[model samples]
Target: MSPLQKIGAFGAALAVSFGAAYGVGALVGPFDSGSKSEAKQSAHQGAGHQEADAESETEGAASPVVPAGLQVTEGGYSLDLATTALVADRAGEVRFTVRGKDGAPVTSYRVEHEKELHLIVASRDLTEYRHLHPTRAADGTWSAPVTLEEAGSYRVFADFTPAGAAKNLTLGSDLTVTGAYAARQAPEPVREVTVDGYTVRLDGELVAGKGSELGFTVSRAGRPVALEPYLGANGHLVALRTGDLAYLHVHPHDDKAGATKVAFTADVPSTGSYRLFLDFKADGKVRTAAFTAGTDQHAHG
Candidate 1:
């Protein structure tokens, strides 16, 4: 993720008004791995989850505002990944712990969008994306199946809320997958992308510093395929800047779905290139369709 932004109109009050409070949580030492002392790693497993402010209304949360998925720690919560390196093509476990202000593993989380926590993994170029829900143990460690399968640097994001917090926290860290890395560029903005015989089309442009309307339509063999609610929504959209992997959280306007379409809005902080991953469930399985988009400034005539 890119560096934190400078304060602006949606800076202080807007951030705080969103329901995030700086608690009495103390500043702790850097969390290296999942092996910290029990005093530091096992106490505050968590309180609960809340997504009432996950995204802006037109965008995802309540009102349009700055983007998320950039910082490793915000509001005293940190996403602690056990390791930063992985082997390509090896299906392995990506383990992590959510550390609260007390420097202890958070154990409780209120459900949001039908999940306690949502984990997203994607390569820097936006070529590979995976949406996962990790299983958290009593000790506060969350683990899930992950296989980079390709040599590239990837970003791992933990999106969730802790108990009374009003908004969702999307914290991210980097992972180096070793093999033979071949960097690639994001594709040109397109109306459609295909995967596993499913074709998904993009119906919007990401506008810099503004909330932009976005929509998606899924089809196969040129026929609209009905989409089912996944994680309490017809679709979940993840947007990432091509180079730095700066994250943007997006949510559908509603949970209802048509034969093959789900609509959402996205708030982008700056202009550049982006790769979008849309996740939808149908036919008893969840599938992802990826697309590429550029900000209006870059795509402007």
Candidate 2:
């Protein structure tokens, strides 16, 4: 067989092995049952007394689901960082792994958004942000080259789907950079930002608990610049809540390429200040425009 064909065969076999192992619950649809079981467990509250259990069930149904990326360990998955501290002067290696409930590094993961895993790092003050993917070794240790010039606390998030999990998981851990540090205040609310000679404007407000309508237009040198599709979409947006750096991956709803404007709906978990990074491709290069944004909760004095 040709080398390319052999590689394709190997990848197919790998995917089949993972899916077959994880597809066990397919008989009774255990994946579906897991959700129902959680709801039942939350409502059951034991067989002792029915009075408080009944009342608690109503409250449980009304409560919102806990947002992702707020915890380092959840649902039997943990983000294990090899080193939590980094020197701030030069390029350094960041190493980590995703350990499953079996207390071993996870070697199999279903690809999402064309990648097996995604790593996000951002300053606590919302000034610096990076979207990176690390290379995984046979031992499942993932490492990437990272640089942080400024000294401050940062949030490192791991987003991925385990071979057995039915849904994507986002976990975050704290990263400390050692040095003298001063934080920049979240920039005043602004609808527009400029980067790499590209001028982009934001339209719409973020409403807590509902998908907020957001729109962006791109221009350059006094004329509208044609936008090319990047990441299978006209544009990509990453919104980080100011305080905890809660991560939200918002994709453009419109798919037409070469259009200057892109639209998205972002359902923020809460009302707060958020920093948005919009990445768009033009002139054969991708550029990012950053904006400081506030939700409806901050609209009133």
TM-scores of the candidates are 0.75, 0.75
Cα lDDT listed for each candidate: 0.61, 0.60
Residue 74 of model 2 has an lDDT of 70
> Deviation in angstroms for 79 in model 2?
0.3
What are the per-residue Cα lDDT tens digits for candidate 1 across 1-301?
1222211111221110100111111111111111212221111111111112223255553643434666688779998999789899897889999999999999987665556777888887666677777788999999987777678888898877687765556788988889988867655545666666777776654456554456688888998989886665688666676676766555565655554788764344456666667677766567777666655564321
| Cα lDDT over the full model 2 | 0.60
Tens digits of per-residue lDDT for model 2, 246-269: 666555555685798987654553
Distance from true location, Cα of 131 in model 2, Å = 0.8
Looking at model 1, residue 74 earns an lDDT score of 72
